[model samples]
Target: MALLEVRDLVVSYGKIRAVKGISFDVEEGQIVCLIGTNGAGKTTTLRTLSGLIRPAKGSISFDGTALTSVPAHKIVSLGMAHSPEGRRIFPRMTVEENLRLGAYSRRDKETDDDLRKVFDLFPVLAERRSQPAGTFSGGEQQMLAMGRAMMSRPRLLLLDEPSMGLSPLMMKKIMSTVADLRAGGTTILLVEQNAQAALKLADVGYVLEVGKIVLSGTGPELLTSDEVRKAYLGED
Candidate 1:
């Protein structure tokens, strides 16, 4: 079975149908990227999967268990973590404190080990563990956000716009870490506006337009496709 399954999903903001019957899946230990332009329901898809927004219709199943009706907190405990857009770290809290909060639902003996793993992934976070998250540069805050999500020891991770609001160098740094995360055994469902970076890292890429999947293929396939190259890859 797929590690994550979103089937015929529909979501709405009042009368505005945001996700109009979308479907997708992520396999274990694979990086799956959802790429689209703004207002294309990319964020909406992640939010619904993370339980921030309830779906109007369809099923969301993780590890073969239905999660559509589960609360966000409950979903976290079920081994899924969401790193939302805008790098929503606790501004006033110490970096360590924010990371600790991510493990609130975890009671396993390996909690400390997981924390160490996150530290290793972003050594800068360890260096600034005592500092307020708000004090870090945008790139640093983004690292902290991913580190915080790692605290949960999730089986599947949902990343929304992980490279947003960062310099080109910072975007490369963060994207490299995402590749490392997959090597370390975390399944990822990534929603990103940065189509190039996302497709490069993804095992499979799905293109979303107007709340529906318009195309999907392996990373290099989409990268080399004439249509995808013209529309998203910015080929002349």
Candidate 2:
């Protein structure tokens, strides 16, 4: 069975529906990317999976547990972590402080080991461990956001627009970290508008438009597909 399964998921903002019955799965040890334009429900889908937003109609199963009814805080304890869009870090807080909050759901308050692991993943974060998050560059802040989420020691890591607002060099660093995480056994569900980069790194790819999946395929397959090439890759 897939590590994370989302079936017929629908989400709404009052009268307007943001997600209309989309479904996908993330297998263990693979990177599955959902690539789309802005406002295509990619962020909304990740938010719902994180329990920050409830699905109006659908089911989310993570590691064999039904997550639709689970609260946001509780969802973190179930081995799923969301590094949301916008790199929502606690600016005033120290980098360590921000990362520690991610482990709040864990029964064990001892997070030293996890902290070390996250630092290893992002050495710059380790260098600025005591600095206020607000003082860092956008790329640095993004690293902290992903590291903070990692403090939860999740089985399934949900990444939303991780390459957003980053330089080519910075974006490459972040993407490389993603591959490292996968190599270390973290199943990832990624949402990105940078289709070329995301699709190149992904094991599987899904194309979303207006809250619905328009296509699905392996990374190489979708990269070569005419539809994805035109719509997302900016190729004629």
Return the top candidate by lDDT.
2
The whole-model C-alpha lDDT of candidate 2 against the native structure comes to 0.93
Per-prediction count of colliding residue pairs?
0, 0
Off by over 4 Å in 2: none
Tens digits of per-residue lDDT for model 1, 50-87: 88899999999999999889999999999999998989
lDDT, candidate 2, 72-125, per-residue tens? 998888889999899999999999999999898888856999999998989998
Structural RMSD, model 1: 1.0
Q: Stretches of candidate 1 above 4 Å error? A: none
TM-score of each model, in listed order: 0.97, 0.98
Q: Give me the displacement of residue 14 in model 1, in angstroms.
A: 0.3
